[model samples]
Target chain A: MNAADVLDGGVLDAARALRERRVSVADLVAESLGRINAISGLNAYVDVFGDQALSLAQAHQTMLDCGYDLGPLHGIPVSLKDNVDMAGVVTTAGSAILKDNVPVADASVVSALKRAGAIVVGKNNMHEFAWGGTTANPHYGTAGNAWDASRSPAGSSGGSASAVAARTVFASIGTDTGGSVRNPAALNGVSGIRPTIGRVSNGGVFPLAWTLDTVGPIAKSSQDCAVVLQAVAGHDPRDLQTSAEPVPDYLAELERPLAGIRIGWIHDYSVKDVQPAVRTAFEAATATFESLGAIVTAVAIPDLDAIVDALVVLDAAEPSALHGRWLRERGDEYGPDVRAQLEAGFVLSAVDYVQAQRYRTHIRARFAEAFRAVDAILTPTLPFTAPRIGQDVIDIGGRDRDVHTANMQFTALASVPGLPALNVPMGFDAGGLPTGLQIITPAFEEGRALRLGHRFQMATTFHLKAPPR
Target chain B: MDETDSIRCRLRAHGIRETEAAVGLAASWLRNAARVRAVVEEVVGPAAGPVTAFTHVPAGLHGEERRERR
Candidate 1:
């Protein structure tokens, strides 16, 4: 097969071909590098480790010759969002403050990937310190949408989604705090999974909001996401938040049928004020689930708006406390928007932060109660498709809403409760931009989300659709 | 002190030097405080103390495999 065909087939297909000697690891790495260099204008990658990637690929080939197979991800070239450490490389969490801060050890997730034989291709770009949803970064140029270069790939993990969608890399690891990973995946038309918080360690990832942050995979398909999750999902001693629970075989769960599964849709909160196209696509997704023999039900949760308000409090205050010293010493180094947000965090009283957490416990109980009657919950990942680059306000259901709030509303439902959520490409809107279907499962039940996402992909061609190059 | 001035003092106390932008941010907070207060009164119990920790994943729940709880 040709290089384009092999790369477009995604991580799982490429790995199968490698094991069968249909393609060389070095040749695959070369193809990924060539694509990365070709799309430099996307600003998806802040740094490309071409030599290191090739060296790693060569080493994988040597291991294969010795009959030592590491795993499914062996020899696959993957990119890391800049917040993740890579030993000697500068782990700039998309900020000038950490410009010279290089780590001496790899992040636990990165180490797991290395052990699984995945080659590190580069570090992807992100929002400055992951403080914003739009990756229209001041330090690194924005990561443009794969469907339309004039539009944004919503961030802070915009680069990883863009790189995966553009076929520059088979998959990329990204951090999600308040929908950073899934928003970009929705806009760029790829698969992203924000695993249950603490399913993967946050030891070496730069902190945005430690309580809200999670590292996950953005890739070509839900199956690819499961493979990546299988490699990285486990407990680590460094992160106290990580539970000592057993990690399941996520890849093995992907083939489970959709029959007899119960899925819930909460229309009041999930569909309110959404774009018409997104609403239409979401309705079709429910119909698709029903046709696949899954039982779909409508459920309601109390005090959703209150939960969101409390989330705003928690999201704001945590980052403020974390960046307190840096904001005081080098406040001028941060972008004006980020600086404004940090300042807003300063104004929140201790009472406000405590009340928000108490509200979080309340909301957590509500979701837990809802989950007892269903296997998963379904919603639109974002209210709309990719907005025009630099467009701050968007029209949603005849009302003007800030792009950040509109992009974050649906995704934050899962984020607030620390549930595992998956963003699957549903289909394209009128303007040819993709709409996303979000599947959220109970905490640590990432396999349920992936199983449903895999079944959806099998019944549709959305995951296989390529952007106009 | 007025609402804006009160926030300006807090900003300075937090080592923020600039007042104009921070004050503008403070105005929004003051506006939103009414809504935040309503939620706090309704959902947050009076006896509830400051939440210092979060239970991310329940201990007994394993991923997909239902392993015996530790």
Candidate 2:
């Protein structure tokens, strides 16, 4: 297959091709690296080490020739968000403060992916400290939506999401603090999952909020995410917060039918002013889910707004707390916007901090109750189409709404509740920007959400659609 | 009405000095509670003092220190 055809194949197909000796790891790695260079205009990567990737791919090929199976991702080239530590590499988190910060070891996730035989092609850019919703970084230039260069790729995982969407990398990992992973995934037209906080270790990844920080995959398909997740998910004693709960075979669960699953749709979370096209596309997705033997229910999640608010507050507070000193002494070192938000975090009170934690505990129960009645919750990943770069707002239902808040509306909720939400491309909006239908399930129930999302994608043409390369 | 400002003052009044250049220590700790707390009140409605997780840093820094010790 040609580069375009190879790039379009999902991770499993590509891996199966490599496993069966139909494709060379060197070829795939070279193609991905070439695309990354060609799409340098997208600013999707923080750094790309083409030589290193080729070396790793060759090493894996050598092992396979010796009848050695490294793992599921033997020859796959995977990009990581810059915030993740990769031993010899600097982890900037797209910030100037840690621009020179290098690690002596790889993050658990990076280590796991490497152990599973995935090639680390490069590090993707992100909003400073994973703070903002829009990936317009003052430090690293904003990563444009692959399909529409003029539009914003949602942040702080924007670069990772954009890279995958742009076919610059087979798949990339992004941290979802508020809506970092899903918003970018939605806007850039890809699949990403913010697995339950403790379900995935946060050992070496930069922290946005210890309470809400979870590392997840931004991939071309839920199946791809499962492949990536298998390598990354598991308890690391290093992360005391990681659950001892058994990690299921996520890929095996992906093939299960979605029949009789109860899915809840939140029209309110859909936002009051979603573009008519987005709403119609989202509804069509819901109808598709309904047709697949899944019962769609509209359920009100109590304290939904408060939960999102609490999550934002908590997310802001923790990062600010973790990075507060660096910000104070070297405030100029940060990107202007990240510094501003971190400064805002410093202004919150101790009571407010406690309240956010208490709110997290209080709000999680409400979602738990809702999940008892439904297998998953569904909403649009983003309420509107992607906005133009430098366009900080959009006209929503006649009102020009702030992009950050609007982009985060549906996504922040899942963070607060600590649930697993999958962002699957639904269709383009009026602007031809990709829109995603977010599927959320009870904490650690990524299986249910993935099964439902996989089925939905199987019945729809959206996942098969691609950005103009 | 200025919740952000109230948080600011609270962080200041309580003397939450940052350990590094990146964070403000105290105020940064409270953001999520404020946002989620507001919604909790909206959804659950009218929480008494018991439902609130806040323990006022007593009039003195001593009280705040003691509270932290807990």
Could you estimate the TM-score for every candidate?
A: 0.96, 0.89
Q: How high is the lDDT of residue A26 in model 2?
A: 88
Give the CAPRI class of candidate 1.
Answer: acceptable
Give fnat for candidates 1, 2 and onward, in order: 0.29, 0.27
How high a TM-score does candidate 1 get?
A: 0.96
lDDT of 2 by residue, A1-469 (tens): 6545676788777867887777788888999998999888888987998999998878889998787887668888889999999999899988888889998989999989888888999999888888887777778788888888878898889899989988877789899877888889998889999997677889899888877789999998888888888889978998887877677788778777877877887646654568777889888988898888889888886556665566667766677788766865786787766766676676665677766666666666666566666777888888887888888788877788877667767887687667688999999875678998888876666766777778788898787777887
DockQ scores of the candidates:
0.35, 0.14
Q: Write the per-residue lDDT of candidate 1 for residues A1-469, one digit (tens) a residue.
A: 8666788996778878888888889989999999999888888999999998998889999998788999889998899999999999999899888899999999999999999999999999999999888888888788888889889999999999999999988899999989998999999999999998878999888989988899999998999999999999888998888766678888878877888888999858777788999999898988988999999998887778765566677788899899989888898888888888888788888877777776666667677777766778899999999999999999988899989767778888888778889999998889899999999987778888999999999888999999988
Clashing pairs for predicted structure model 1, backbone only: none
Which candidate comes out best when scored by DockQ?
A: 1
